[model samples]
Target: MTNLTCFKAYDIRGKLGTELNEEIAYKIGRAYGQIYCPQKVVIGCDIRLTSEDLKQATIRGLNDAGVNVLDLGMTGTEEVYFGAFHLDVQGGIEVTASHNPMDYNGMKLVRENARPIGADSGLKDIQALAESGHFQEMSQKGTTEQYNILPEFVDHLMTYIDPAKLRPLKLVMNAGNGAAGHVIDALEDKFKQLSIPIEFIKIHHEPNGHFPNGIPNPILIENRGYTSDAVLAHQADMGIAWDGDFDRCFLFDEKGQFIEGYYIVGLLAQAFLLKQKGEKIVHDPRLVWNTLDILKEYDGIAVQSQSGHSFIKDMMREHNAVYGGEMSAHHYFRDFAYCDSGMIPWLLATVVLSETKQSLSSLVEDMIKKFPCSGEINFKVKDTQKTIQKIFDHFADQKPMLDQTDGVSLDFGAWRLNVRASNTEPLLRLNIESRADQNPKPMQDYVDELTQLIQS
Candidate 1:
């Protein structure tokens, strides 16, 4: 029996040979096929070195379980979701590690209409089946066929934003050597047809499986320089960069300042609200002041949820939310079956700027000043539960008035902090937000105090 440790809370992920391999992937595929038993299944993968091999193994497993496969070769996570909905497939699975290190990989599964299969849903059953290593034999094996969906995906994306509406602006786009470059190249051709005077400066735009340096995660301070340099060199209106699988994107202003994902969430939420007045928008509770305030001003309903793709997507479907976003830059859309996409957010942001006649910087200027955040700080600790309890106990006196939605969020008059355990790591994630009048000093001081406590 395969080790069940790789069966994560949300999806399957682990190191390459030791924890995950072709055999394990094949078993997972068979288990997913047996459990869902859809008429057809859509499969896609990122550009990690081991992805193709894993994909083959997964397809074999699915085929063995009598599930026909529609292979969307070498595409983003969203493409698989699109294929699932567009082709009316029974379900879909994207074999991607996302922004994880090269040595690691995982799978993101979905039912019909791209509905996610999370822990509470069907992932646990699939894990149990895979671990049991038993399955009913099929009368006839399923078949596999390859289909290229890039052109179709690009065309669908363009429907959301009119290129002619955009102003003449220079933009820098860094694909971080992921699968986004091909899609971005196709988008550039579409922009040319509209006569929109835009320059696209690109870096690491190739789909290299080696990932040369590391998975192109822009959140790390080290990766910021590449995007920042491109923005400055081109004197562009803004810079947009994506992670390894293009499931999440990061942004930079013309001045080369890294914009927080929370701010983008508010920006995009405001944009959507303007179009559909009083529409419901879902957002994570980690950073809510600016977003909630903006939604209220627009007379729209603000729905708060826990941070994570599965949680946010589920809430979006439940509320029939027009849009949803998390602090991690994962953006969800109603039109896309409530699935998160790294490409659509930037496209929608561009359209928002075009309609508002405001620069990206100008749109988010006030939001930055309104909510001065310390970003997310991670602490590697021995005991995650004990650490969380320690922090919760320290602030227990103020617990009655605090927000305990997803974690322990304590509010003072001027500042607030949210400390929660990471679902994917052995670390406590801390986020600090301060009011406009308060100096960031107090926030920093609290962070220092908390860090010391956690470390000790």
Candidate 2:
């Protein structure tokens, strides 16, 4: 059997005509149906040009396998996750190539309760079956039906905050020409119906598959300027921008300054801890200083897990954690079936700002000062293993505390570094942070030292 390059460790993704196509999507659906043999499954697609056709092809295969399908047309990835557990369906799939270039398309799969199907879990098996073009014919075909999950989804989101308590604040909301526009419109309608004192100043509000304003990713410095400029131009209280599928969102403070996601983790952890003081919080090992300190002050337990959505979700389930966050802007909630949401985070942030009566910058400025970080820096190495080992051996003499959680995390007295290969991308990521060293010397020295060892 030929290997499909699109099948990554976590999900399926690749260029449109080359690495993936309608045929691959159909076979994947059939393979999944045969393996799970579920009575019903949920399906959704993003605003990508190819997603709807792929969604239909996948449904055809699932129907061929005698599995019923509930199609929620043109939605965010979180909506598919919501449909999986929120409805009486056995599994869910979303056809979306989040943040990828124009010519790419992919899918995210989940089993019941919105549990992910990563490589170690069941993705390999599905790949094997899909690669081998063999299938069993069924006597009867399953049926397909259209379902609208927006109302239920909005109802679920409102549970996070009381609208009446929200103060009047103008928000610069940028959908980035992705699937987020519909959700924004829905929320706006609800706000007007409920008379919640919130105003949304929308930019790039329409869903355009061509992405005329460039790809819908806010993480890139070049792409972030639009949101920052909009916030400043509109004089809005804050700004929010999302990627293509709207599963992950980046935040901007009132001053149009981008907030590092590491501190946002701490901020969100506080939001959850305020409601339930002793509940658990699961965080990635890459950046933990801020999360740990905040949790300690709030009497909340912080559990460290390897970075990645699958690892974080599993850890949250095992610990019964109220929330789990990665420094890369992915925030998972226990209420949302242990799945991440781009929309929920900003809503909760608004609530926090209203309650504390502070600017968004004021809330996280102190955390930024206390634990200065290098943010995440990526390096492409010819040999990732050898590079990591070189850094580890060079630091052996220092005898820093080491944790092999996601990658290798070495803790010196004044600073700490976590180096690991990315699960999705082809690069090694390094994260460094120091305690109360507002200056760059401590962080810079270790970064330079590590870079030398890694690239030497």
Candidate 3:
């Protein structure tokens, strides 16, 4: 029996051989079919080498359970979501490990209309079914068919924003050898026809399963160097990069400075609110002050949600939000069935900058100064529960307020910190944000104190 330790809070992610394999993927697919019992299902994958094999096995399970499959060959997770909603299918699945290492693989599941299935939702049922290792058999076998949704998807995406309004802006795009390169290629061709003076400086655009060095996660300080260098070398207006499956995007300004996802969230929120005034915007609890402030200023309703794609999407749908964003770079749109997209954010951002005649740097400069944050810090620890309890106990009495929406968030007068354990890794992730202080000493002291407490 395969140990389902990897059945996480959000999705199923684990090292390839020991925890996840073809058999387990098949069982998951079978269980998913039994639970959802959809007439038609759509499936897709990233560029990871294991993706195709896992997709095939998963399809086998679905077919065995008499569920017809629409296999979207080699597309991003969002594409699967789009296929599900566009085709009016009952459910969808994307076989991807996202930004994890090459040795890792996972699945992102969604119900009809792109509703996410996380641990609190249908994930636990799927997990139990997989563990039981016994499922009802279907008398009739299902059929499988493959289709290319790229051309239609690209066409549909282009309709959202007008390229004619965009000024000719030179930009650098680093795919980091992930699945984003192909999508970029399709968009570049369309941009050419619009007479947009957009020159794309590409690097590591090819999809390589080995990932040779590391996964294409731009959140890491080390990964930013490559993209920064590309921006400087090309002297572009801005730089954009995506993770393995192109589900989220990272940006660098013309000066090669990496922009935080929080600022991007604000920018996107403001853009959406300007067009659709009074529309609700859903944002994660982590680092939401900037987003909330912007939304309120724009007369947009701000809805705070737990930090996760599943939660954000569900909340967005319930609120009928025009947009949803997370500090982790996931951006969701009501038009896209409330599904997060790695491709749309950059496209929309470019349109925003181009139409306004403002550089990306200038747009986010004020927000950065207003909310100085120490980008997420991860600490490897043996006992996540103990560390969380220690932090909670230490600050519970002294802090003005404490919340456990995502993890442990303590708010003081002008400063807030959230410490949450990663669902996929054995580490505690800490995020701190604060308003202007007389000096940086207080924040530094707080970080030092927390570090010492955890280390000691």
Cα deviation in Å at residue 165, candidate 2? Answer: 0.9
- Overall lDDT per candidate, in order of appearance: 0.86, 0.90, 0.87
Per-residue lDDT over 1-456 for candidate 1, one digit per residue giving the tens place of the 0 to 100 score: 655767766777878997789998999999999998887899999899899899999999999999999998898888998988888688999998887777888888889988888888899999999999889999999999998888888888888887668777788999988889989999899788877677788888888988775679888778889899989988988899899889899989889989999999998898888888989899987877888879988878989888878888899999999999888789999998898888889888778777887888889999888878888888888887788789878877765358878878878767778888877556788888878876546567877888888898
Tell me which residue pairs clash in candidate 1: none
In model 1, what lDDT does residue 309 have?
81
Q: Write the per-residue lDDT of candidate 3 for residues 88-138, one digit (tens) a residue.
A: 699999999998877889999999888899999999999898889788989
**TM-score of model 1 vs. true structure:** 0.97
* Candidate 2 clashes between residue pairs 3 or more apart in a chain or in different chains: none
What would the TM-scores of all predictions be? 0.97, 0.96, 0.97
* Count of clashes in candidate 1: 0
Number of the top-ranking candidate, with lDDT as the measure: 2
lDDT of 2 by residue, 1-456 (tens): 767878876788888888889988999999999889989999999999999999999999899999999999999999999999999999999999898778889999999989999888899999999888688999999999999999999989989889878999999999999999999999999999999999999999999998988899887778889999999998988999999999898999989988878999999999888888999999999988889999999889999988877788889999999999999899999999999999999999999999999999999999988998888888989877788888889889989999998889998857888999977656899999998754447667877877787777
